[model samples]
Target: MLQRIQTVYMILSILVMGALYMWFPVVEDAAKNVVIDKSEPLVLGLILAPVVLTLISIFNFKKRQHQFVLNRLSIILNFVLLGVFVYRSLKVSGETLVSEKGIGVLLPIISIVFLVLANKAIKRDEDLVKSVDRLR
Candidate 1:
């Protein structure tokens, strides 16, 4: 499991998500104060669900199909998180709610990249195993 490249990618994805959750600010006000972050329940859940899923995928290494499915679900969740951030930043209700978008918004994209790479590696491993089994 740890020897697999996909495992490394999944670990990186987990780290990136952890950083986003702990340190990065989602949005800032005109005064540069953090306006949005994990303090919001929806945002918190969105940010955390992927991390949990990825961890589960990492552990379920023996079941390649299950791992792949989990990663796909994680990717979908990240997209939803990105959509929420975009919507929040774009929402205009007679005031500038999001004065500045922080680096946290991009974290999901990074995580998605890692997850995709991990999925690709997982697929390759699965293919290799299938090919070897055919030799029997």
Candidate 2:
């Protein structure tokens, strides 16, 4: 299954969520305080959701439908995370003094793209299976 393109996509998504976040700065405040990730509870949860879900989805090779479902969920969560990022960037507040934007802010979008590509591969595999079954 590791050889599968979808598996590769899911793995890349995991790296983005788990490893990349550790190194990249998400937002830099005007005071020179760099935030790699938001400390807010809900935001943290949303950030970790795809990491856990993608790991779970990767092992669900036998249950393609369930894997597909998990990817869909991950995609939705990423969208919500994106919205949060937007809100945080636009909000007029003291602590929300985001003077600089970083590449980390776009990680969720990149992850969503990976998830979508994985889902497409999954669907292709499912269709292939169905076609073969019909042949038999």
Candidate 3:
């Protein structure tokens, strides 16, 4: 099942998440080069949760409905991450707090795209299974 296309999509999602952790800057400031690393415990957890969920979904291929639910959950998590980025970009409390949006902010969007593709594939498989069941 790991050889499936959805698995590849999940792996790519994981890699993009890792790249965000390793080299990307989530937030920048006017004077500072980079403001926030993915290393913050909460940030790190949020960054990795989708990867974990996607992996779980990949391995649970025998349960297509469960896998579909997991993918939807992962998509919701990505949307939360995107919301956080947008929030950080909008409101500032102090001179040092001004948020400069970085290209790193786009990582969640990329992950979401892959997740959507994976979900689409999962839906196709589910449909095929249903159609086959009707044949017998």
lDDT of 1 by residue, 11-91 (tens): 999999998888765565555555566789999999999999999999999999999999999999999999988787665
lDDT of 2: 0.81
Query: TM-score: which candidate is best?
Result: 1
Cα TM-score of candidate 2: 0.84
lDDT of each model, Cα atoms only?
Answer: 0.87, 0.81, 0.78
Please tell me which model should have the higher TM-score, number 1 or number 2: 1
Q: Extract clashing residue pairs from model 3.
A: none
- Backbone collision count in every prediction? 0, 0, 0
Q: Can you rank all candidates by TM-score, best first?
A: 1, 2, 3
- Tens digits of per-residue lDDT, candidate 2, 8-121, equal 999999888775456544565566554435665777888888889999999998889999999999999989888877776655345534444545568888899999999999
Where does candidate 1 have its weakest 10-residue lDDT segment?
92-101
Q: Give the TM-score of candidate 1.
A: 0.88
Model 3 C-alpha lDDT per residue in residues 18-123, reported as the tens digit of each score: 8777875545555664446577776787788988998898889899889889989988988888777667555533443333345567888998899899889888
